[model samples]
Target: MAVDVLNESNWAVEPRVFSDLGLWVMDQMKISTDCDLTIIFNEPDAMEELHLRWMNLEGPTDVMSFPMDELRPGDGTTDVEGMLGDIVLCPAVAATQAQSAGHSTIEELMLLTIHGCLHLLGFDHSDKDQEKEMFGIQRQLLLTYLAARPGELNEVIPLEISGE
Candidate 1:
């Protein structure tokens, strides 16, 4: 997968980290490596505008997903691929969340990235049943990713999501 990351915020965003993680995530989802995805880091102002415009909410959110191809996790034998869509992230909001959750900002960003990808894959947590399924998958993905790439991780990031 071609994972492109753009930093438009003042925060120190590491494009490679997100790109690599995104690619791995798509692979895990049985998506073709030819797929393209974009992750953009925006400031609070831009995020707030998007939150209001898209969700009719008043505050900036940590992440928002705009899906393109409306893709789903492929069947085990299919190599699904397409323009998966964009994940707009607010690092500033994530930093505050990280602080409150007692973890590094990067960890929060990673979780958000995973959440955003799942969204692009047609996952939602609007209801309890949906939340259970989504969060469980999320937890498994994070734990597996962390275990497989300990060298890339500085520490065992505490799971901050309402994931089982």
Candidate 2:
């Protein structure tokens, strides 16, 4: 898969870190070699609009995925060089979630990036079985990535889901 990073936010996180996470997620998902992914980091206000539309919430969300179902393999619209879809992220919300979860903002942002990428690949947690499977893979991927990063220290927490 091809990965492109676009940063339009003033958040404190490093751009390289976010880009690396996007690449990491694409690798873990085993996305088709033909797929293309673009990640855009935007300010909280811009992300809030997507949060309201897709998530029905009133605040910034860490990440949101916009998958392109119209662009398929063999479609003339897909250039061998075109993107599959976009993943938008808000570093502000990621920082807050990291503070609550007791991890670095970078880690939280990476987790959200992976989650969004999975959604692009048709993974969802809208039900019990799906939630279990999706979140389980998420937690595992996050732990493995964190463990492999040099000088990174993080505590492993049990996976849990609250509310339906």
For model 2, how does the per-residue alpha-carbon lDDT over 50-87 read when each residue is reduced to its tens digit? 89988899888888999875333233333332355888
Model 1: CA > 4 A from native: 155-164
**lDDT (10s digit) by residue, model 1, range 60-127:** 99999999999999898998978899999998899899899998888889999999999999999999
Number of clashing pairs, model 1? Answer: 1
* Candidate 2 runs further than 4 Å off: 69-82, 152-164
Among residues 3 or more apart in sequence or in different chains, the pairs in candidate 2 whose N, CA or C atoms overlap within 3 Å are none
Candidate of highest lDDT: 1
In candidate 1, which residue pairs get closer than 3 Å at backbone N, Cα or C atoms, i.e. clash?
Answer: 1-33
